[model samples]
Target: MSQRRQLPMPRPRELLTNSSHFFAFGFGSGFAPKAPGTVGTLVAIPVYWLIADWSLPLYALWLVVTFALGVYWCERSSKALGLHDHPGIVWDEMVGYWLTMLLAPPGWQWMLAGFVLFRLFDIAKPWPVSLADRKIHGGLGIMIDDILAAVYAWLAMQLLAYFFVG
Candidate 1:
């Protein structure tokens, strides 16, 4: 068996010095020693609460702007750390969780459902999400798979709300 190359993890000073690295790491949630993506998604809950009451247009605009910025942040952080889609770069997970909650019902139950669904899709990476993960490269590649997973989770959230939350 061939030995796989190991990428160097970013040092704390590096994260402290770089805004891109800090954000891409989900404000340090990505520093979790295990399941950083899940930790990052958990960090996003408060952010979602802060914006959940905004008008739909405003929320949509935030999503667009944040996603675009996440691309840049992830790219810069990945380059600094010399890795593509580093597990610690979880800005994508934060954004994907926000996307999953779009137009979701106002309740902790719904929020929990969105979280579970988003994590499921993100972890499973079904269909197009898996395809993107396999074929895409760089920051866009790192982000696109999560975006696809979010779409799947969003749809599932909608369906669940229609059936149960109504």
Candidate 2:
């Protein structure tokens, strides 16, 4: 048991397997019993701080790669958990929130807006987003809807920027 406890955590791998199961999961933020999506979105704030210094292109590239890979990991982990889109697999939210922030002004206002828009779009699931959420299942299903939500949030943020930001 000591050995098991001491074992290193898995790292996020782009391959079909080997993901930073816990870290990629926002330190288990996805495991919330209720409002898992809400928890997932909330956990993304600090991630933004950590990656704030990186170039936008790099951050975008990393998010894209992670989302693409998360399709499988999320599905597999969900399956393993005997649940579909378990809250514990919140890597999807992390990537999506990052996507939303990429378009923002990178300050308190933008962070606040990104948080609100991402959560709203994620929960509202308008148009094809709703369709995708209901029709799709498994990893891609979990990841895609959030991706769409992020896109919507990003657009909304851009609109706000146009109207509100200088």
Model 2 stretches with alpha carbons more than 4 Å out: 1-24
Q: Write the per-residue lDDT of candidate 1 for residues 1-166, one digit (tens) a residue.
A: 2122244567778789889998999989888878889999999999998999999999999999989999999998899888899998999999999999999999888888889999999999999999999999888988899999999999999999899867
Q: What TM-score would every model get versus the actual structure? A: 0.94, 0.81
Worst lDDT run of 10 residues, candidate 2, spans: 7-16
Q: Candidates' lDDT values, in order? A: 0.91, 0.76
lDDT of 2 at 13: 46
Worst 10-residue lDDT window, candidate 1: 1-10
- Cα displacement (angstroms), candidate 1, residue 57, comes to 0.5
Give me the displacement of residue 73 in model 1, in angstroms: 0.6
Model 1 scores a C-alpha lDDT of 0.91
